[model samples]
Target: MPISYTDQQIREKAASLGLIQEGADLPRQLRGKVVAAMAYGDAAERHQAPEPQLAGEIVIHGSSILIDGEHFPWLVAAQPMDIGLNPDGVSTVRLTLMAASVQVIRPEPRPESEH
Candidate 1:
């Protein structure tokens, strides 16, 4: 069964994943961040796999936002509708704005020495 999540739940999950700052309330906060929107089931499986999948980049055009070149309303993108788990068992929220499930992800933060 698909897992359902409230906006608060999704925000908590995204914060935990470091995809967004805790308490972020704007879509612009995620602007330019790399995200993957895939089929819900496929996303679940891919999250457990070793290789990562690249979908589209997020482009915020003033009052609007676009992912993979398709338009996504600010309200829908800001409020994720579902949640899933990544390989490490951490929760990843899913946005239903696209025909595919949306997974907002970022690479693990490297230590300052690596920079």
Candidate 2:
């Protein structure tokens, strides 16, 4: 069973991610502003690289969003929720978007003293 949260809950979560401004309308602002989209010069070539797909059990439990078996607390989600199927014929749920975001993760910043 999935959990549900109120709009206030979602608002708070989005705020922590810096996805919304101090006084922005949470509902209206989230329409297309928070998601990351890819623009490719050639649509065909883009698809050849890797396509996004949705193949996981997405549910809201309490304040967490559970995708596949991963427990992502609070409405933390990358819009354009990309996905891909596992080559294996297993029914295991997998969050492909989470995996793909690896390229964007930056190393922890060093202290000012170290710089």
lDDT of 1 by residue, 25-115 (tens): 5264553232322235457886785776454455555546576688865465445345464556545445645345567699899999999
Clashing pairs in 2: 3-60, 3-61, 53-83
Clashing pairs for model 1 are none
State in Å the error of residue 41, model 2.
34
Q: Give the poorly placed runs of model 1, Cα more than 4 Å off.
A: 26-115
User: What overall lDDT goes with each candidate model?
Assistant: 0.56, 0.52
The weakest ten consecutive residues by lDDT in model 1 span 31-40
User: Residue-wise lDDT of candidate 2 within 1-115, one digit each (tens)?
Assistant: 3334556655665676677766556776573333321112234455674666664666645446676778864444445433454567534433323343345568899999999
Count clashing pairs, candidate 2.
Answer: 3
| Error in Å for residue 6 of model 2 | 0.7
The superposed Cα distance between candidate 2 and the true structure at residue 69, in angstroms, equals 33
